[model samples]
Target chain A: GQQVMQIPQYQHVQEGEDFTTYCNSSTTLSNIQWYKQRPGGHPVFLIQLVKSGEVKKQKRLTFQFGEAKKNSSLHITATQTTDVGTYFCAGRFYNFGNEKLTFGTGTRLTIIP
Target chain B: DVKVTQSSRYLVKRTGEKVFLECVQDMDHENMFWYRQDPGLGLRLIYFSYDVKMKEKGDIPEGYSVSREKKERFSLILESASTNQTSMYLCASSFPRTGNQNQPQHFGDGTRLSIL
Candidate 1:
């Protein structure tokens, strides 16, 4: 079974500071998706990356897929209080012709006001 | 705006009791999934149904079952609830745009179940 590891299990940053979370995998992945879950809320889709070395941006947030497709990272510039939540990276892989998505343990981010 | 609805937002049951968690999706999705979320374990899949009357076991499916008699409805059943089963249950639905492409999943608010 493939597993995804997320670094910085918990983090706290002063408001207006930068924040980043890394997702790593031992094996190559077909694609990777990022999700955000607010306190007492369900996980919501943020973005997905497929091609290697791909970089995508959503306003102040940037996402990048590693050149080898074995890792991904999410970076937020000037984090705000509303940016506080748990970020998760899910990787898709195939096993015996069956496709599965392995979700990372997640990185909890806290913004200090 | 896709809406995935779970029957209950919170539930509590005693050990050894049979519990059923219901989920419904307004969007006509081809896939429905059940996952349990723990503090450090992330989201562990329990079961998924791609079509009506079809189900597949996920990473952690022991002591659990699923029913998908209709396309819009998916149910997760606990044969015998235990204290270990106390966690947040999430239901998701996705539409397969193509055969191999995996689309974004729409999740319900989730059910926080506690076993006494």
Candidate 2:
């Protein structure tokens, strides 16, 4: 079975500060996807990383995929109150010709306005 | 835009009662999934269907079952609901493009179920 673990189960930062969350996997993943869930809301798809050592940016957020394909990170620059939410990383594993996903425990972020 | 709709936004059922959560997707997707979201557990897959009449048990499928009679509909059934089963359930669908390694999943608002 594949497992994804995320660090800093909770984080709090002042507005305009920076924040980052890390996701590590016990096994190699074919691809990884990031999701955000606001309080009392459903999870929304954010981004997906597939290539090794790939980096993508969306506005003030940056995502990086490890060269080994076993780790990923999401960094938010100049965080705002609207950025408060739980971030999750899901890894897709191909096992025995079956592709399934394993989600990390998640990192809940809070921004102080 | 992909639209995944869950039958209910909230539900309350007594212990030992049978529960059914329905999900429908307007887009024709080959893969549909059911996941339960808890406080710290994130989202754990309960079941997934790749096609009609085809389903695979996910990480936590005990006490839960799924039905896929049509490509656009998927259902999750709880034979006997328990207090421990109370959680937010989400339904998602994805269409994998040919030769593409990543497929974005569209999720519904989710059904918040509580067992009394």
Best by TM-score: 1
Query: Candidate 1 chain A: worst 10 consecutive residues by lDDT?
Result: A93-102
lDDT (C-alpha) at residue B17 in model 1: 100
iRMS for all predictions? 1.8, 1.8
Residue pairs in steric clash, candidate 1? Answer: none
Model 1: CA > 4 A from native: A96-99, B97-100
- Candidate 2 lDDT over A1-113, as tens digits, reads 66799988999999999999999987788888999999888788999998999999999999999999999999999999999999999888756234467889999999888
Q: Which candidate should be chosen as best, given lDDT against the real structure?
A: 1
Candidate 1, position B91, lDDT: 97
Writing each residue's lDDT as its tens digit, candidate 2 over B1-116 gives: 88999999999999999999999999999889999998878899999988899999899999999999999999999999999999999999987534536577889999999999
**Clash statistics: count for each candidate:** 0, 0
A17, model 1: CA deviation in Å? 0.9
lDDT per residue, candidate 1, B10-115, as tens digits?
A: 9999999999999999999989999999998889888988889998888899999999999999999999999999999999999863554578989999999999
Model 1 chain B lowest lDDT segment of ten: B94-103
